[model samples]
Target: MKIQKFGAGVFTIENFLSKKECDAYIHDSESRGYEVATINAISGPEINKEIRNNDRVIFDDTELANALFQRAKGFLPASLHGW
Candidate 1:
């Protein structure tokens, strides 16, 4: 994993997921279906098209999440300076 840091806490990891991995994720999400995306406001989570107009799938797949996190862990800092 190659990480590139830009100014102002911006960063990017090239090829974090290969084409095959990305395709699998897309397929899985599509199979589950997507709902209108929502945004978190002071009022709480709600669909706000102006803010974010897209579809998303919210699911609980801890195994997948942990796998991805582990793959990227080596490129991540233990903690941020101010956060």
Candidate 2:
């Protein structure tokens, strides 16, 4: 697999997640009650109730977070490691 690197210091691995993985992620996120997306504003953030377009899910699972990080860490720049 070829990792595409952009001039703006952005790297992407095409087809990183398979179809089954995507389906499983969507199912898990929906089951966890994270389908609702929030609206961001200068004052504060508010829950969007009208049209549900974005399904934002927070990474509270440490194991999952660590695993994903490990998988993508090699593609990331070293300067972004600490912060």
Candidate 3:
């Protein structure tokens, strides 16, 4: 993987995931299905087409999530902003 610093707090990671891995993720998410994406509003979560007109899937796949996180952890700072 190649990591480039575009600016402060901004970066571009190249080849983060292989084509096969990406394809698998797409298949998994599609199998789960999707719903109209929403944004956090002042009141609460709501759909706002003007802000975003996209679909997303909210599923619980702890194993997959952890695997991805581990893969990314190697490329991320150990801590951010003292957190």
TM-score for each prediction? 0.81, 0.63, 0.80
Error of 2 at 70 (Å): 0.6
Best by TM-score: 1
Looking at candidate 3, what is the lDDT of residue 25?
85
Q: Residue by residue across 1-83, what tens digits does model 1's lDDT show?
A: 68889977789999999999989999999999999999998999999888899998999989989999999898887888956
Candidate 2 ranges beyond 4 A from true positions: 5-7, 39-42, 47-53, 80-83
Native RMSD of candidate 3 (Å): 1.7
Q: Write the per-residue lDDT of candidate 2 for residues 1-83, one digit (tens) a residue.
A: 45888766677787777889889998987777764677886778777577446767775789988887898787777786466
* Sort by TM-score, top down from the best: 1, 3, 2
Model 3 misplaced stretches (Cα beyond 4 Å): none
Please write out the lDDT profile of model 3 over residues 44-73, one tens digit for every residue.
999999999999999788997798899888
Better candidate number, 1 or 3, judged by TM-score: 1
What's the TM for model 3? Answer: 0.80
User: lDDT order of candidates, best first?
Assistant: 1, 3, 2
Number of the candidate with higher TM-score, 1 or 2: 1
What Cα-based lDDT does every candidate model obtain? Answer: 0.91, 0.76, 0.89
* Candidate 3 lDDT: 0.89
Candidate 1 local Cα displacement, residue 7, angstroms: 3.6
lDDT of 2 at 27: 95
Alpha-carbon RMSD to native, per candidate? 1.8, 3.9, 1.7
